[model samples]
Target chain A: MTRVHDMGGRYGDGPVRPEPQGVPAFAADWHPRALALTVAAGGLGKWNIDMARHAREALAPRDYNRFAYYEKWIAALADMLVSEGLVSRAELTDGQGAAPGPEGPAAGPVTVQKVRQMIANGAPADRAASAPARFVPGDRVRTRRPAANLFVDGGHTRLPQYAAGAEGRVLRVHGSHVLPDRSAHKLGEGAEPLYAVAFAASALWARPEHPRDEVVLDLWQSYLEAV
Target chain B: MPHDHSDHDHPHALLPPDPALRVKALETILTRKGLIEPAALDEIIDTYQNRIGPQNGAQVVARAWTDPAFRADLLRDATAVVADMGFYGRQGEHIVAVENTPEQHNMVVCTLCSCYPWPLLGIPPGWYKSDAYRARAVREPRRVLSEFGVELPEDTAVRVWDSTAEVRYLVVPMRPAGTEAMDAAALARLVTRDSMIGTGLVTAP
Candidate 1:
């Protein structure tokens, strides 16, 4: 159940590295193509962002440390293309295999205008929340550990390990959105009320150094229980 | 993108690991299938390369520093307010601006994954996506901040926002002393990506 991607509060990897002040967005020629392939495939409107994330995290845990950031994107893109029947494994491996097209107009050679429109109008994650809002702002809540049936392999989650079983106060109620835990699994994504729960530094770690500090996590209603 | 393919790497490492060749192969395959338009790819690339980035976030922070009503508006509805200024979408759809004051300072991190406001901040810096950062940012933020040369008063409460859902946070850092004469544009220049991320501070002029 412990996916290597969920790296909250784990120690001993290495020191936090310094970032270059101005690394170009596309550091290499492949970088732009990697971004394009993923973005273009996404334009098909077949999968949500959660599924894309799962595909990335789905990489072998051993490979997590080895692959570069965009490398992960390429790997995931290849997997998604093949598994979704958009491309075949042979095409991905040797660039020779062909894939079947869906009915109607194929969303290819995405137009420049379409790109601008998509960027201008951000993908609002506000789904149609069905249930009434459960907890309001200022309510005490704790993050529930991943429920048993949440995932088959127990791979991906927005819920970090540090906040599990930890208590915090609801700072604000972010209107209901698709709960990613379910969405990643292609399961039912019943929109639910989400809250910004704030926990003291002492609550998350043992014998905290910065007691004055706190962490606020945006937790969905299902991941929380009243304290 | 530097490829670090060690001779001691795993079996999968032996595949077409050259980034350029690999991407080219993928692109060729997609093009053959009519799945990707190079024009669309150019727009996407140009957007991240030239159009939007952290400067957009700095402008927002600068406006908040100089304009009171806009600050209130930003705190109330940052997504719409930020969108009003023409910076909205993607990783920045729902923004919640947490102000840094003498009492409390705010920092943003996504512990589970790297969920940054790409529309505002463009792509996150390399460090922000590191496994070390994703793990340590929450456990020892002060140390991490210090490592980045950011020092806060011991009394000031540090609030780290682990952006877990669609909502993204922008840290409205306190303006440095003796900057009252400066205009929004000048103040905006003083703002750094790290300051907004709360790992570093805006230095006093």
Candidate 2:
């Protein structure tokens, strides 16, 4: 949905801050734990990564930008854990909630060795190549909104606001990918061919001196149409 | 859009934002329930911070700089080329390396979220996750690049790669001039994480 998180082309936030040479990944002690818990819980295979993303997108638009990256992660992790019955609200508040007690599916008790292997193997989303890609590189195409309403709907979407209508050429056709839109809502992946659509910066904005500059957006088959 | 409007959640803004107490609370609950092991959690964090990071990608870029065959392989099939070099994992299983020449400059941004190639670049830098960068990088890339002190010539066509899928991008920045004599090991030292991210250039030594 068109929330603060989808802040492409929009402005007024601030200048890009220079990241110092060597900053620690986790600022606070909890930051690492927050990231670790989210990844570990997400490893359970209960909800797709897309679904977990909505947990943050579902937050108030104001809160979305205010929370730090890992903070949003922790929020999403907590929301998923509680709503999925992995932990109870009382338990979250009390910090001593009883386990689900073998009633429903548990997400994880991920071992160190398993995480190492998973990190090595990686969670690749590439599915088998499907029907011949409709649009090959050099094919002119336009991105379609498709969704009825972006913000109120509160689901997953890769279509950024900046490049939705702006025309472009397909730079390359990435093989079939798990359609994040459907996967985010618990719908089956129904993998489809994805393409990297390139739109000229001149077309995207009213700026000058960028006739040759372009932005390449990775789009799902459904998000595009032959132009 | 029914949300958790329960009394239990009322202390949200006053409490949920607190990284300290909330994490302690969560650790207490998840550990008591036998979900997460502290050691395993730290291991994942350590891997990204130390073992897997820009140094790995720097090595790849360095090798490509010195070896024409490896460079060709990287451009053709970065996934296999990078994997063959032993850099494969989360946020980086499938990657496409876009080459930047004097005529073309490539930049990377997730736009949707901070979807960086963690296994290659370690954790994403803070600016990468900033609201200003995500919003403007795709819109005014030249301006964004300038903000990062990357002044490109007007003739250079800037290509901003919006990482919308699981397939992450690593910009094979043009090797700086006056480094022809440098070997792969020394060249690796020159590749900063920002250079690979396309936000900064690999300045001459």
Candidate 3:
């Protein structure tokens, strides 16, 4: 049997204690500018897939430092969401009337789940219905020409410092979607379904490579072209 | 010293949601967004369908426990060998292996996002995606672990890994007592999904 210990008290050695007030207090007008930037850039969900992919790849267990960057970025996004009137202060304070747990008012609202629910229940359809795929399944296609200057989203871009302008067969087709590589407008690759094209190892790298080894890449539809 | 076993059952009691349903819910949400790129989703479905899960990790761990040579290979280069089993791609190309001993414990968390070794461990458990766990695990690992029935002594430094790009980590849990004579298959059965993720340690039946 594992003996459960009360280790909560040990975590308070630093200035990490939860505020005594049931809710975090700040001047109502003290809005986070980073979030306002996201709103100005566009809705938070506009950056969803890129963010998820970043979180999944760059924020693994060993990369604590990078994960901290994501956390800060996400927090900034959240603050922007609230200030933009996309999410109300009351919604964050009281979860549209759900039972409050011991955590506090912000616990329910500030979570990604909460923001997602808000998106589900309310985010406007700026571009939800557009058709973005340039190719169909089974099409022989290749990656479009790489942009001369690399454009990153919020932070440092993780798109291979190499590996752009690669070509592959369109094993399957996805709809039009936002290109991870920021376009001329500087907005995220907007509302589009990305594609997963499988490239043969021999094609991606020249020298000697096993023909059987293949690399499958998830690319926005806009990134592909007819082979 | 004789120990009371009450805590063990309670922690294990918080079973996770059905994987298919959870995936379904997520898929439904993405699909509605018109974001479900069928081709990409198919690859995700295929990768998850064919490989990636606890069963795959258990096989590797069990093989390592029994074979010194395989253990060396796993420790030397997990990503390549795991990819050799056809499980490597963008997220799992880099790998680091951590061993779990009776005295010293280890657990994995992204704290930022769900950076999991999906090629090896299959899909991550639902709790790994929970905001409560994600926020609290790095800040209060021992406490969060105790809630999961993993009690490490204060002296044992529980390294909470924050998985990121360029590196990945997996836990090689210590074999339970009285399991030395057990076959690899039997030992494999003892390897729980949580143990592989470093959320909970495994015990023999």
> Ten-residue segment with the worst summed lDDT in candidate 1 chain A?
A146-155
State the DockQ of every prediction: 0.42, 0.54, 0.03
* Docking band of candidate 2: medium
Give candidate 3's whole-model lDDT: 0.47
Model 3, residue B43: distance off in Å is 6.2
**Candidate 1 per-residue lDDT over residues B1-205, each given as its tens digit:** 2221221222223337786777777777777676666688888888887887889999999999999999999999998898889888777888888899999988888876789888778888888888888888887888888888788888988888888888989998889998999999999989888888888788767
Error of 1 at B204 (Å): 3.4
DockQ of model 3 vs. true complex: 0.03
Models sorted by DockQ, best on top: 2, 1, 3
Error of 2 at B20 (Å): 1.7
Q: What C-alpha lDDT, on a 0 to 100 scale, does residue A154 get in candidate 3?
A: 26
Evaluate all candidate structures by whole-model CA lDDT and list the values in order.
0.77, 0.78, 0.47
C-alpha positional error of residue A131 in candidate 3 after TM-score superposition, expressed in Å:
42
Best by DockQ: 2
Q: How would you encode candidate 1's per-residue C-alpha lDDT over A1-227 as one tens digit per residue? A: 44667787788868877775532345677887887777777876667888888777777776666888888888777776666667655556676445535652344445677677777776787877777788888888888864322544554567777778888898888888987777766677778888889999899998576768898888888888899
Model 1 chain B — which ten-residue stretch has the worst lDDT?
B1-10
Better of 1 and 2 by TM-score: 2
Chain B vs. true chain B: TM-score for each candidate?
0.90, 0.91, 0.75
**Which portions of model 2 show Cα errors greater than 4 Å?**
A22-25, A99-105, A146-152, B1-17
Please report the interface RMSD of model 1 to 1 decimal.
6.5
